[model samples]
Target: MKRTRVALALAPFVLLTGCGGLSGGPPSAAPGTNAPPTVPRTATVTVTVSPSTPSASASPGSPGESKLGPPTSTREVTVRRTTDNPPLVLGVRFAKHDGFDRVVIDLSGGRPGYSAHWVPKLVQDGSGDPIDAPGGAYLQVTVTPANAHGETGSPTWVGGPVFHAGLGNVRSVVKTGDFEAVVGVGIVLDHRAAFRILEQRDPQRLVVDVAH
Candidate 1:
């Protein structure tokens, strides 16, 4: 399909520019119910999750998947201008792509500023406690000017706390934090390799692809 999205170009896996932190998620619309039917989900594949992921975060992108460039080690982040509404994290999903594993963070309202980097291990945001994310390497992603819950303290995210991707490289994606306007996503990978992040409009979403 014809896709219209901006490429957050960087040195391979490195970010093109730096950004600030802390923001909430998308709208009040129920998860999956209002999300655009853009990315397709491919389910006929291998599954290695220990307990199995109970969230749509492990599902594949629908049809009309955008053409993101090859994953690179220098890639790091992508930023979206913040809005008064800030967005609500509608859902998180992942799928095994041709040469990498893909992670999609669905959002609403207006896309917000976000950043990510490689961390030695996963940890809770406020408490700083180490998270038991299954994998050999860890990637720390923070979505800011956003929220995973609505104003009434009701959760807007459509998944559980931690979900396993079980792709060739990505093992799982964990929600490490949701304090204030920031929502953290911890991705566990089998090994360290180049990856890139992009912001796609039309049912706004954040896409991360890690090399296999």
Candidate 2:
């Protein structure tokens, strides 16, 4: 536990007049009061994403959990740049929901910025343990329809959600013309409602409600 360069970058869709949820969340600061963590400085990128259809399914969470659902169309999303760190490029997005298919990641710029929490890796069928976080050095992932190209809609980004399936998960290294990013989503869904992080006054987001 000493790999904190902290940077998971992805920037493209920063309007925020008010965007509540899609599993892509970030907005809420109060209770214990939050917001005071933004650091970055490093660089690397060569990511890409193109979509249509391919794979989904991951069932593990009971040691530390994260689940959020509701998004039935949004494929092809990638962004990368990592190696020695701090240019902050690691954006990732994929959506589809009839049962499952959602992956969104964004860690931006650097100086010690962007730090998501969750760790445990290796599971593409080898069987078990899949969820990772490295620096906190930002993001790194690989998720497919689940069992290797199961679902089909055509377009193809090599299985839609797998982390390095064809490159493209939103990128970083800070040079999208200099800063202005937002992401605050914390989901855990499969039914059983109870996901909340609402702090209004001037902040609006972080909402995951699933239970049907």
Q: For each candidate in the order shown, give its overall lDDT on alpha carbons.
A: 0.68, 0.25
Error of 2 at 74 (Å): 22
Worst 10 residues of 1 by lDDT: 17-26
* Candidate 2 worst ten-residue window by lDDT: 198-207
Residue 105, model 1: lDDT of 91
Task: List the candidates' TM-scores in order.
Answer: 0.67, 0.18
lDDT of 1 by residue, 169-208 (tens): 9999999888989999999999987676655666678877
Report the C-alpha lDDT of model 2 over 118-175, residue by residue, as the tens digit.
1232222223344232111222222111111113522112322223221122212111
Give the count of colliding residue pairs in each prediction.
Answer: 31, 46
The candidate that wins on TM-score is: 1
